[model samples]
Target: MSFSPTGQAQVLVWAPEAEQVELILNEGNTSVPLKKEEFGYWSVTTDLVSPGDAYKFRLNDDQEFPDPVSLFQPNGVHGASQAYDETSFNWEDDNWQCPLLEDFVLYELHTGTFTPEGTFAGIEQKLDHLLELGVTAIEIMPVAQFPGDRNWGYDGVFPFAVQDSYGGPEGLQRMVSACHQKGMAVVLDIVYNHLGPEGNYLGAYGPYFTNKYNTPWGPAINFDDAWCDGVRRYFSENLLMWFRDFHVDAVRLDAVHAIKDFSPVHILREMKQQVNQLMETTGRTHYMIVELDLNDTCFINPLEEQGYGMDAQWVDEFHHALRVTMTGDQTGYYSDFTGISDLGKAYKDAYVYDGQFSPHRQKSFGVKAEGNPGKQFIVFTQNHDQVGNRMLGERLTELVSYEMQKLAAGAVILSPFLPMLWMGEEYAEPNRFQYFVSHTDPELAEAVRQGRKAEFGMFHAQGEAPDPMAEETFLQSKLQWDLLPLEPHQTLFRYYQTLLKLRKELPALKHLDRQNLEVVENDAHKTLQLRRWHDEEQVLCLMNFSNAPQTVALPLNAKTWNLVLDSAAPEWKGPQPSAPTANAGTEVLMQPESLLVFRGQS
Candidate 1:
């Protein structure tokens, strides 16, 4: 239950199976009986319950459970729920405004492992570094209340509550305020597909789950079942809470494909409508971005097109295609990608396998995004899922050479779609973002440890999986900030900074016209030619992913061009690559595993 501003609180719970229910407050010592209302709801209006008070609900005068819609479980999910005043924080973001989606250079990070402190305050301290890197916004991993501490946050149980270990509600408010103060927006990752297995008491309070559909996290939420109105109300309220209360600019909905709802107006559409209405009422910038495996553009398409009208969505296919091309490790789902063509297709057409058969799933995956804008797709080389899900959690830096890293960065930063950088990826962090969790249950912990070890067999990785329960496991995953000033690392950092600067200052690079972008792939020479234009200014990007040097003729818009950023330049500690000799006709010589960007004004 949520507490209000006038020092009074109303507690309401849906407990149809309980014979009697009571509200336990003031440290679970005082019990107050609640009156049962229609629709199987038990409620109580209490003046004694004030903010900072700890309470829980007693079912049948025997069992107790923390509030299902708790604002802050300061003592974890299993502990007593605390009454937190959402409007208590004195916000300082009155003049703050978010940049457009196309202008965002997103930096994604996990709170706990981002710094040694592993709290929201810790993240606030690192905002200066992001500002220096030319980042437009920060997209943080999930911060909802989960069991113990070290979860990756996909296993969040209480979607409304901030993780207590990460400094609770006030801490989160401080972080958001800090971001706005620095002219950077904050995007929060939230899960709606399923709640964590542990501390999930919504089913006990109401028909919050349906057994008709099964999900990886267990039974799907009752979005289209009996007593589903309350189910929908619960999530819609949670989505607005982050925007209205926490002041997060955007909400990144995780794994929308797993959310099963056969309703005429889908839950996603309903959420978009509510968020748009909120934007109309409150003159603040708010947007919704979802991560879905289905390559449907309806999520981000216009409402007149019978779409949900979302702002943007994550593109995993782009990352997969790029990874296969750069790393040449085509195991598992990466097997479906024939790097040369697939990478070019995803880069030019947004989706490589749109409505095409996938040999891996044995079914057609994704629909075409032909009409969607390029800015609606957010692309990244590495993320928490792609890296942490690994048994050893080895980042791309550990698997690939330094030149390929720069090539990938150029591809992401210079592309029309929004670019995102994982934590410490700019400086080539040496630490592995290993998967770690601190479940109090020994059986679950052991099972996770074994499962992680077995999953790496396909990758043929060496070594035993680190124990998730160990404190060292979490500590080992923390970013090494000292490595930023070291050799090769500092050069890459400068390269990323310069690329972002060019992206912001150059019109051709910033243009979001999906139709104007062109790609030329030559399997014979293992090279790619990208032509992007805005008005009369044009950018020619030549990429060489192969180990051998290659030369390609440029279909130049102008005979004269300026080399803006070359990945193989001596400044980046490469092989001191040189521009192609003018005597060799119009062909430009490229270094091995490097990308060269040229700008021309016609």
Candidate 2:
């Protein structure tokens, strides 16, 4: 059961069906035979099997295969595992501290498409860009090794290893150091629910997965089954390893709803407690954010109240309402969102479908999330799943006008909730982030490609689905870093920068007090107005979802209200006017597909 010092040289395999197993070293020079044990695990050891050494496993006389638990892949997912030294890289972020969860402006980025190089070093070069954008934290998509070099990282099988294409563990450390040096926190996305189909060998080692519960991604993890205690510890230890070894500030648990556990203490609660204890021991405020489909606020609720402890969760309701209003596409999940009324509810209550009958799910879904701090919810107009899951992976920019896009950005950033911006959303990168995977087995690869096409066929009818395996799909997804210097892209980037500054500088906008939010909706006209007041400081947000300008009556009592920010304004470099006037109790004209923010003055 011993692993190498560098976490490489697995040196063991257990295949009862196979007669023999051999460790295939680099260049096909030599083969090291593994001895079968009584417990059914083949074993071997060699000093030559150091980190950065390319090697794989050969079953009987079959072709060599990459190690299932490989720590680093120097040549990509299809290549043999190479030895990697995690301690050799020099880090200069000793004085860096992670910002509190309440203050986080997370910018989620897919490392594979974040830059032309699409490596950790490539992202490192853009740390200053994020810092200047006023992002308090950068949420990187999973770094764990998946089947191939190109992936969204959700299908990662080796949870402990960094993807070889991304510079392995050392590259990750370098990225973290660069982020910390720029006064920004790094949150790594981790998947514990299920491993990718290819290169998965955890079941061979032990019961890492179980059939106790069903998951969309196949077998559920064996968290509550027999011999599962060590399995639980394995994941917890992995979390600690990331924070301690790679200096990651936080972890965004991907699709945690799929993790089934009925133990006396739930695994999530235990993990949260462990992270808190680690925070105390290391004098660092490490956080865990979960992505759960359940609308339950228990995750963010205090642990003392019999709730699972989590810093925050993604509010899909907000994204849904915003998307429906902007795009007018009521297909699939968007079917539940109809008009500005739903959008207003989302703005005020964080969940538009709470306990309401959903036409899409064909059932009453979502729980009321009242009295919860808005900061407990992470709201985004578009994220990886929402965009990538689409038929063509079309961005919001493709469906809406530039004015509407800016308005959507304004609504998300200025809202009370913790705002998250996806990679390329700032500059509206024209490329789409389509579903991509690299599978070693040809049959599995074809199955994946066909599965994706069939899945999207339910919603879209006409065009041929893009080949997920095609090199062009991956190439198209890469962020055009040069676009940021262009006209509208620069303007959009500045708009994001301005919104973040306003969120930080304006007292009323910074208020996360959900109790203070008020919403007024005009369903017929497809417009909504949201007002927030913190003591004497007050701000009003008006958004028109329709394609035509509409006049709305103001109900607030104010001698004068100054126009602060307008999505359609020339300052935003959009077609709409620079300013709009409004009088108390008077009907004010709001530009179509615009968001206007006004502040009450004495």
Candidate 3:
């Protein structure tokens, strides 16, 4: 795993079943027999190898493959694994620190499609723009090494290696260095549930995968299986490597519900404990967020309370509610939600389906999320999953009118929970964020295409599902950055900038408390209002979801309310200004698909 001062490399490979293993180096011309050790590990110390040297293991003098925990795969996963000295990169973030979780306005973006360059350097080019947009953190999708130059990054096979196409390890470090310069935190998305089909050689190393449990990808990882101590160590070290070496402020674990581990202490809890230790050692604040569909509060709950102790979880019920209320399409899992009331519940509480009967799942789902802090629940209207998983990969802009789109932005930005805006949503990019993949293995590529197409049948979507392997699919999904400065896009972009400005400057908005936030819904007219307060300051966010103007009875506790911002104002090219001018217990009219922010005194 490391090298000695004499330029000798201590190469170790876990091959339990192999009787003989050889370390092959120098273009396969040199082979050194490794001494077998206790509990199935082969090791050898050779003075010939150094950092940046390409090497692989020969199992039983026949099978040869890259190292399972390779630090850098310069020649792709199928090629020899290269030794990388992580200390070689010069990082400039010595005094840098991440902002408080409550102060974070997250922006989730795919590194590849975020810019035309499709590299870490490309994303670094846009950091200033993100800082100006009031983004505290940029959550980059998985940049782990996958098969080819282009991928969504979920198919990453090498946990340690940064995508060779995305400017490798140094490139990622530079990107992080750039983010730190602007006081922005960097969060990386990592998949641990299952490995991708291509370039997955972990099974050759040890009992890394088990047939006892099955994942959507294939055999589940051997978390609780026989000879699983090594398996757990392998992945846990990967997590630490990111935090320690890559300087990642946070890690967004993808699909923890799919990770099946039956043990006294779950692997996620163990990872969380180790991360806390790392944070204490480094004297830095680190966050662990999860993308969970189970809707179980156990993921973010403290370890003493028998929880995984993750910092936050994505609550997509708000997105579902907003989508259903705006588009009125209740297909698939959207069947559980029914318009503004559901949206109101998600706003007041964290989740709409908290212990409620789900028609989509045909059972009661989710635990109560009320007691958790609002920041613990990350809410978003549009993200990679919500948009890219679609049959046609249409964004919210394609689903609703321009007015409703602004309302969607208002709902997310004004919500008590931590909110994340997907890439290009600020300027209303028109490109479809479709599911795309580039697998070198032709069979795997076709299989992915087939699986993605088959999934759309559950939703009963019309037209043919786009081919996920097609290069055109990925190219078409890239953001239309040029459109941001154009007509309506520029206006919407400014509207978002203004909303974020209010969120930062307003005390009531900034000092968010989830428990006491209130929601008033006028279901008859499809109008919803939220009353949130902190100390002596209070704010009201009112909106009409319907296509017709509605007169809503205001529940203003103060003598008078002043309109803070209006989506229906002519300044933003709306039909008319839907300004609420009334005292406590009076009524006010709201334009169709309009959201109005009001400030009032206690």
Candidate 4:
């Protein structure tokens, strides 16, 4: 909806199924009939509705519902939609240039749990903390308006409206502007797979869903079926709205595998083309990162190469292999990973299961991402799913020792791939990041509780899963910022800061070229030696996942390897006081469950 200078607004609705459409303004105090146009669209130029006016659409004299393209749901999902002027907010980030994808050190966070306030403004208050941690980008979880204030955001029913509880549209603009001023990029997570069950009135408008494919949630979106053109336009406009109106640097599409689109011109490819056009038109940098379960390179590959042209993708294989090697937990997907050797493959070839027969799926999975650069893959030890989906939502800090936690940090940060840190992972916060929701429907809430129980059947969790509908569950998942200045947590925070600093200062680590990388895994000793070079600057990352000290022979070279950072050093509160350097043909003693970084020049 766009308002004219004379307070007249132009309203448009796409309701192919409705015989009559009425614009109900201010709780039906004023109503204006819409004229039907071709292609199942209804439009009207009305003076009754203006900016900030609460409105709803009445279909064929039926029950009134919030706008399908509502910009603001002030009273929640089941309430009236408020008119919001996207051009009203004064942006202060005219000169903000987003960092290159290769340089992005992402910090994934949930808006409601990152702070006590649980709003976008609350996030703005912590910009200095993130800056001190050396995070280049902040990937916020879904902020689309869900049923209630406590959801993890996957249950969002209004795709266009910003969460009213999270300070609404203006609040997000403030957060983005603040981040840009601090030289940080923002990546917003979006869901195009399925909308939340409650308050979902799209079915009354048109065939927005189809039975062609079934997603884990429910019926897939109608992206390739009849009347898919309108459905496609709705989402494509949403993709551009983030960059154009909200000033978001990028969007992390949640579960692209679940988006069932079989069109000849794939929806993903169309999105990429539109993004490119927007970037060209606005002269601003933008990217589209996808969360993909399938380890397919077609999504990240270039358009010229018959690919979806996505900027990057999250690689769960790296996290799976790393977790298996460190924790030795062979439960669901971890059974497919073989330990440090698979992690070695992840370091060399982004995908560990490249056309290999999987015991999990009982079939060959994943194709080789051979020529793809290391920057194309995003690697992390813990994410929202890896942590929150657990029955108890145990973070790495809860399951592993202090040394192992540091080792995990080193494993991700010291690798060539883009590194992302989950909220509170830096300080090793003890609170569990469990799943929670606040659905109004009692039956729906009960269904969620039972669903969580069924989902955890694969893993042998000792006790019953926490009640996802409980308010305490959401409160318990929040990050404890007070722990930052406390013991062990502060040390770990410094350790991560130092590692990020080294990554920026060292050429061998800063350059993300994987072609010059060589990874050697010793399965018997449970160790990995990674050697990568940029020009004359060479670096070696030695990891020991075993529980016993191992004396590993160093490769004979012309240059001496000097100790850079050691997880087992006394400074990091480890068993060892310091790390030993290795010369040509010499040996170094690696502490149990520790990682060491060394720099050398020839």
Candidate 5:
């Protein structure tokens, strides 16, 4: 089962349906016969295939196709898989260690549109910028191979291979190396819930999928059925490969709620246990974070609590509450969150629907996370799904005023939880993060377009759905790198950088325990305030969601209070207030669509 380290060729192909299978090298220039086993898996071994050598699978009657689990396909999705030498690349991050979860200032970006070049190498050049902006980690959207060169990466079929268009496997390794050198950890967003519609050859190979459960995409993966042990191992091995081979520090599991596993030990727990063992063996503190819409804390709880034991989980409640409070848009899911009370609850409890009614789901769900530390929750104002799934891909910057945008930023960064920022959110880039996919099948493409449009019909009735297949939509989604150098963008970027710096430097803000946090709400005035105090250091944060200025007395007593940050400063083009009055002890004025942070002297 093991090949020599000097670059030998060994392949394991599970093709029970195929009558015959052979290795076709370089478009049928040569062929190597494979040995079939009782389990219906074919095995091949030869020194003929070396790194960069193109090859394919030849089934019965010379029907040749790419390897189902190809490690590298330099030529493209339809091309032959090249022999990939994972150990050839010289890595210089032997001493690199990732920052702790509490120290993470995460920046989420899509690889296909994060820069002008939209390649792995292109992103390497911007690592210094992120490092300078105080980002401790970069969470890249899925890089697994999809149907075409351009995609958002979520519709990936080849979970083990990097996208050939985005510089392939070698390009990705280089990007990770460069990031480690800059003291920034890399978190890869991986989709295990479902594979893309096109090039999904796993079903042809084995029972990689099942009809026992249905996901939004289609039939769910067979993680608990017969031969499902190997299926789960496939994904677990993929996670290990990323951390050991590519030096990725963490993995962000996309849409975990869709992973319907009925096994005694769930796939999430198995993956977590394997990752923990890997971390121990490698002496690296890697993380496994999940994106779940379930609003459940079990994923982030300890294994002793009969939970999945994830390091952190994304809290959609935080984003939903902030979105409704800032924009006041009550269509779709926003209908469940209309008042400032929801925002206040999200700020204090980190889950607005803690066993409460959810009009969108037509069910009462979620459990209260009272004693859990805030570091276990990853809070964001905007993320890929929140923006890209919209009809026009309008980000928070497009709907909320500049002051509210800053307030949103402060609300997340200064809170007791870890914060994540979507790409271009710091500078309020005007570009939209629209959904894009590249499907080879004509019928599949048309179906996708129709389904997308139909889904948005209830929310937005006008205009045709932006073609997910169009090259222009993909190009338009790329980050406008030039905007960072412009006026207002530059100013806002500086503000975000300052906020990150403050979060790192200030002891009061760095405290992430939920027990140390307290919140007060004035729904009538559309105002919410959160007070985080620990060890004699106190921070009072106030946010005004109304369209007009309002004044509210501070809920805490302090001898001296200094104005720290104001979202309504002239820099953000909002009303500026005079210097904070001295000895304001229990009274402070708040501006419309603004956020204020005050540090109190004990």
Candidate 6:
């Protein structure tokens, strides 16, 4: 869809099955016929409609529906689509360049709950908060048009339209420009596996979905089915639109594991090729980070290596292993992990389950990510899925002690891989990030509630899950920004700030070099030692996950180790009066559920 400044609008719709289509403008006041072109395409140009004018397409002159590729559904999803002039918004990021992928410290957030206003402008108001927290990048959950104002964003029906309640397309453009001006990149999460069941009219246009494969949500996207070219082109263009139009630095593809395609060149590889071409043509750096459960290196391997050339992938195994060690609640997928040993494996190798048989999966899972670099894996402790999918949507601090919360932070940040923090994690917000939605259909709402109940049957925990259809559930998920000045929350915030500073300034921590990293795990004491070096600078991380204090041997080298930042220090509210330092061949005692960082030099 394109709009002209002089009250002229033109649209190209792909409705293969329809014999005739009409363009309706001004709430059904004006109607114009569209000419049919090859490949089941329809086009019309008219001066009757202007920018921001509402429009819809009538199929077979029978029933009207919003454009399949609507750019802005100013009205709700059930309402008419609006003509948006993409060139109207002036972007001030012409001189801005995204930071390198390896140097990213991402903070994941939802636009609706990030601020009280629950809009794109709301997020822009809190830019200083993120900057003070030392976040180099902010990954926003999907803004695509969904059934209602509240959603996890996976239920988006329109891939191109920005949610109207969240300030529409112009509001998003402003936020991206604001972030670029603040020297921060934005990562937008998008779901391409399946469109939401409600307000989805893609089937009326063409074979956008196929029954050959099924995802957890429903039928898979028609990537490998008949007449799949249009379907593939539809999503590929959507990917390009975000980068070219909105200036998104990166896109976090949600659940790539659910997308089943049997084509020779997988859809991911194909999208990567297009993205590479776009980057080369525009001379800008952009990244594609995937949320994948299958620990396959083929997704992140170099294109020359006959693999998909994605920039990075979210390593859920790392979070699972880390959580199991901290909480020890072996339910659901947590049963497959063995606490500190798996965390050690995650440190050495990107994936904990590298071709190993799992009791949870009951089959061998994940190939070895041997040649992959540390930057290819994104590790996080409390993401939306990890928190909201729980029975009560409990944050890490809610389930563990204050020290264990600090330990979880250190585990992700001090690791060699890229680190991400969920929304409200830095200041230890007490609110639960529960699943909430406002579907207009009552039966659909009830179905979602039951689905959430069935999804958590394996946990066998007490109490019923919160109702997804409740307005209170959505209200309960909002971040309590006032907690920043509280007792333990302020201390935890400073601890994260110090760790982030060290990550940026320290030589050994700054560079991501997996080849020069070593991990030593002691199961008897539930401790792990990590040593990383770059050039002549070295850093050691000692982590104790046990309930009792334990002693860890330092590196037997000539370099003297100086204590940098210790979670067990009194400054961080630990029981210890002061942090301890050690020399080579000496041992240092680590407090229970604490982490210690040492900077070594000869």
Q: What are the lDDT scores of the predictions, listed in order? A: 0.87, 0.82, 0.87, 0.92, 0.84, 0.90
- Between prediction 2 and prediction 5, which has the larger lDDT? 5
What are the RMSDs of all candidates, in order? 1.7, 3.6, 1.7, 1.2, 1.9, 1.4
Clashing pairs in 2: 51-83, 52-83, 52-84, 53-83
Cα lDDT tens digits, model 1, 73-159, are 988878999888888899999999888888888999999999989999999889999999999899999999999989889889999
lDDT: which candidate is best? 4
For model 6, give the 10-residue run with minimal summed lDDT: 577-586
Error in Å for residue 440 of model 5: 2.6
Give the Å error, residue 287, model 4.
0.4
Task: Indicate the residue-level lDDT of 412 in model 2.
Answer: 92
What's the distance in Å from true for residue 320, model 2?
0.8
Residue 166 shift from truth in candidate 6, angstroms = 0.7
Instruction: Tell me the tens digit of each residue's lDDT in model 3 across 529-554.
Output: 89888877778888888999987766
Error of 6 at 224 (Å): 1.3
Name the TM-score of candidate 4.
0.98
Candidate 6: the clashing residue pairs are none
Cα lDDT of model 2 by residue, 512-564, tens digit: 88888788888788888888878888888888888898887765556667788
What are the per-residue Cα lDDT tens digits for candidate 6 across 437-485?
9899989999999988887776556678899989899988999888888
- Across residues 1-602, which tens digit of lDDT does each residue of candidate 4 receive? 76766777888898987899999986688889999998889999987777898999999998899999998999988999999888789999999999999999999999999999999999999999999999999999999999989989999888889999999999999999999999999999999999889888788889999999999889999999999998998899999999999999999999999999889999999999999999999999999999998999999999999999999999999999999999888888899998999999999999998898999999999999998998889999999999998889999998999999998998999899999999999999899999999999999999998999897776554888899999999999999999899899899999999999988899989999999888999999999999888998888888999999987767654368888998999999999843577685678889999988888856
lDDT of 5 by residue, 476-537 (tens): 88888788889788988988987888788778888787887788888788888788887887
Off by over 4 Å in 5: 1-3, 16-20, 37-40, 59-62, 459-462, 571-573, 578-581, 584-586
Clashing pairs in 4: none
The number of clashing residue pairs in each candidate reads 0, 4, 0, 0, 0, 0
**TM, every model:** 0.97, 0.90, 0.97, 0.98, 0.96, 0.98
